[model samples]
Target: MSLRARAATTLVLVAAVLGLGLAIAVHHDPAAGADNATLRWFLDHRTPWATHLATALSTVFAPMWVAIAAVVVSVGLIRRDQILDRGMRVLGTVAIAGALAEVFKLAINRLRPPTIDQIGSPEAAASFPSGHVTGTAALLLAAALTVTASRAARTTAITTASLLSAAVAVSRLYLGAHWLTDVVASIAVAVAAVIAAPVVVDAVLAALRPHLPLRLRSMVDVGGRTSVEAAR
Candidate 1:
């Protein structure tokens, strides 16, 4: 494997292991002392105005909304550039990350912080890997990779995504929607997804291209040219 592929694979494996270990740990004892302490600290420091701000931020990053925004943005960008491949990779990263987060939440079935401590309406979904943080991190990072080509631009994009994700993580914690470990695991998963998304999507499209009908195959651009162009 190339160095890029190796790094992505290593990060993904590390994330998976971290997620699984946290899941098992939380399953045995959902209320880990450190998590409780962090939640309580946020709760203790929250003000009415700050609570409202955090609620709005957290709501914006809610998994469902994030998915909707991703679709809209991807579609818009693809239409503007006529680059189906790039857009798909960007959208796929966010979608896959969000789906995995939901699956983990269901399987882990970890509870959110105590309802009484929450600043807004309680979330009905389980909260092991935070849906908000995962969605926000994935979308921002994926979009960064899609929109920028230079190494410097990529670095800036990653930094911006990380900062925005940190904001989302704080929002989730401030609202008492998730534990500390939940947000941490989500960041790891999002990073892994961002790193692997392009490679995975490219591989899938390449493998499936030969089997697709000519008209359909024309929709895919390989190496900066459409299949139809290559044939011509």
Candidate 2:
């Protein structure tokens, strides 16, 4: 199957898993018990250094930092390669993933764990989907997808991004700010966003082709051909 098809299949499977988990969490409250247990375990094992490190990692996904990162990375990519379309695709993935996470948050409206139950200050927002994980996953996945580098470099980038995303997700759980399923669902959403980004970018470029100036149109045509070739 094609790459996009694989991605779509992965997304469907992850969504199903998340859906089943959410159903259990909502209807039976098993997830809450599990979440509590996990938090207890973390608390039992916690040290000052570990807590500090996790908190630091978690900050990378804060909304302000994420926005700044998106701008910096997108602009850097465009400046380095002059691939405006590709840069936009990266930015679009971050935006779409973040928006989708928020929509899910509002829809689920699951409350965060109580402050007395957690190591850190209480979070007041819905916690079914961890925004930290979602944002970090989206940013990392976008970076991995859009990076133009050697095969080894690309592999390394993807691996590092995945690791970093997982670390951030774990940090949320460690802090008791989110349930396990919250991070899981956010990951599913991030994967879907990353997979759909290029397809969406291509469609947008196609629609704009007719309106682009002749010089710019030719450049796009060449870039499109090169992208297709690279995929092979």
Candidate 3:
């Protein structure tokens, strides 16, 4: 599929999942039984080692770690040249995806699983969409798309990143922090963001190119040299 078509499909799937989840939440339906059962299974399977591993995954994808990663990636991009091109695309995807997840959380306003049923302390925020999963998926998928690396290396990076992101999503469920649908929808949002990032970045650069300083324009003109182009 075309990039735009893929992104649109992902977004439509996200909307469908979100709508179903919302309807279930609103009606207090028995469909939640599956969610509860899944949560219970995770809770029942919790071992110290598993808990430690999940905790580590959660910590690595925490807001603080994400910010640190952004700064590090930003600096690396600056050193490589084309911050407005590559850096902005990566950072913008993460920021926009995160904001979208937060907006959905607020809009859905679904309560998280009870603390008594959870492995850790209860989260205070609404939890229809998982922020951790959303951010991790966006960051990893963006990196997979934007990193300047060998094909084999890039494939390895994406594979590892995807597995890690999935692990983090499972961690959220294991911790009883979010429902299955929440994580699934967040993954869709991330995929959509990754697919759209280059398109958005290219459009923005095209619009700004004419007005930018000659030196800046020249640097950003290389923006077309992206993995998205390579795919074609």
- All candidates' lDDT scores? 0.76, 0.76, 0.76
Clashing residue pairs for model 2: none
**Candidate 3 residue-wise lDDT at 113:** 83
Worst 10 residues of 2 by lDDT: 214-223
Candidate 1 ranges beyond 4 A from true positions: 1-31, 210-232
Where model 2 places Cα greater than 4 Å from the true spot, the runs are 1-7, 10-14, 21-25, 29-33, 213-232
What local lDDT score does residue 95 receive in model 3, on the 0 to 100 scale? Answer: 79
Clashing pairs in 3: none
Task: Spell out the clash pairs found in candidate 1.
Answer: none
Report the poorest 10 consecutive residues by lDDT, candidate 3. 214-223
Q: CA RMSD for every model?
A: 4.2, 3.4, 3.6
Q: Candidate 3: TM-score? A: 0.85
Model 3: residues with Cα > 4 Å off, grouped in runs: 1-7, 28-31, 213-215, 218-232
